[model samples]
Target: MAKAITQIRRVDPTPEELQAQSITKIIGALAENGESIIKMLDIVSQLDQTGILDALDAILKKRVDVAEIMIQQMNQPTMHKIMKNGMNIFKFLGSLNPEQIRMLMDGVGHGIDKATARESDDKKTSLWSLGKAMKKPEVKESLTMMVSILEGMGESLQREKDHVH
Candidate 1:
């Protein structure tokens, strides 16, 4: 534990490293795995359209949609930064006793990661851009869906932060 702390103290990654080793990659890897499974099942779907339908699952079933993932990771980092400001940290630390700090950390710490938030925001950015890019029904539907999902996600995240405290 002590050694881990010393290592953490010694090496705060640069922005590039942080971005390079982010959860976007993990999500992408997961999406890629999903894509392979989808591809394996594509033969069946190609043979029958009725077998497969639904925007969310369909999109996620594809290989690493790098552009989409990139957008999400990009948006998330900004929010994490905003939340982790020195002043905010000090205030947060001050408000909590030792037990509260432990509890706050536990609440915030879960499976949640900086990349998740940024990537979600990235999806929103992608949707806005997507809406601008096309004049077709499918893209319009996708863009609209993305807008609703991303906006709802952002609101939920904000509310989680607000209410959790």
Candidate 2:
């Protein structure tokens, strides 16, 4: 009779070999991301060239003094009014719908264009010319829209008054 046997062996890498392996992996990663690293370095170089880094350093050095001065200015009544007005403007803008804003902008642009075009014409509008313009369909439509807008604003003002009371 014959007997068979199985055996296993293990090999452990030395510390120096492990270090070399790590270095190789690091080099491979550097190669793979070399372009990205170069781009980042270029942006940093631009920032340095523009003196932005120096400005940042200066700001950091005076941070405490700057903060104190800012606090003092903010404590003033003028600053409070400015801040309140800014908030109200933002609130008003927020209240407007995108379509309303678009229409407003379009109206402003058309008004500017008409004004510029009229600069070339030296003709003055007399009562007759005004009556003729009022008879035009486009002019009538614009006047109607303006009246409607003013009515809506008046209603809004009344509502605000009621709410305040």
* Residue 61 alpha-carbon offset, candidate 2, angstroms: 1.2
Best by lDDT: 2
Candidate 2 overall Cα lDDT vs. reference? 0.92
lDDT, candidate 1, 103-164, per-residue tens = 64664565257547767774555676656668877557657866986998899899999999
List per-prediction Cα lDDT, in the order shown: 0.71, 0.92
lDDT by residue for model 2 (1-165), tens? 777657666889999999999999999988999999899999999999999989988989999988899999999999999999999999999998989789878987998899889888988869998898999987898899899999999999999999999
Off by over 4 Å in 2: 1-32, 162-165
What's the C-alpha lDDT at position 65 in model 1?
89
The RMSD (Cα, Å) of candidate 2 is 5.6
- Model 1 misplaced stretches (Cα beyond 4 Å): 1-133
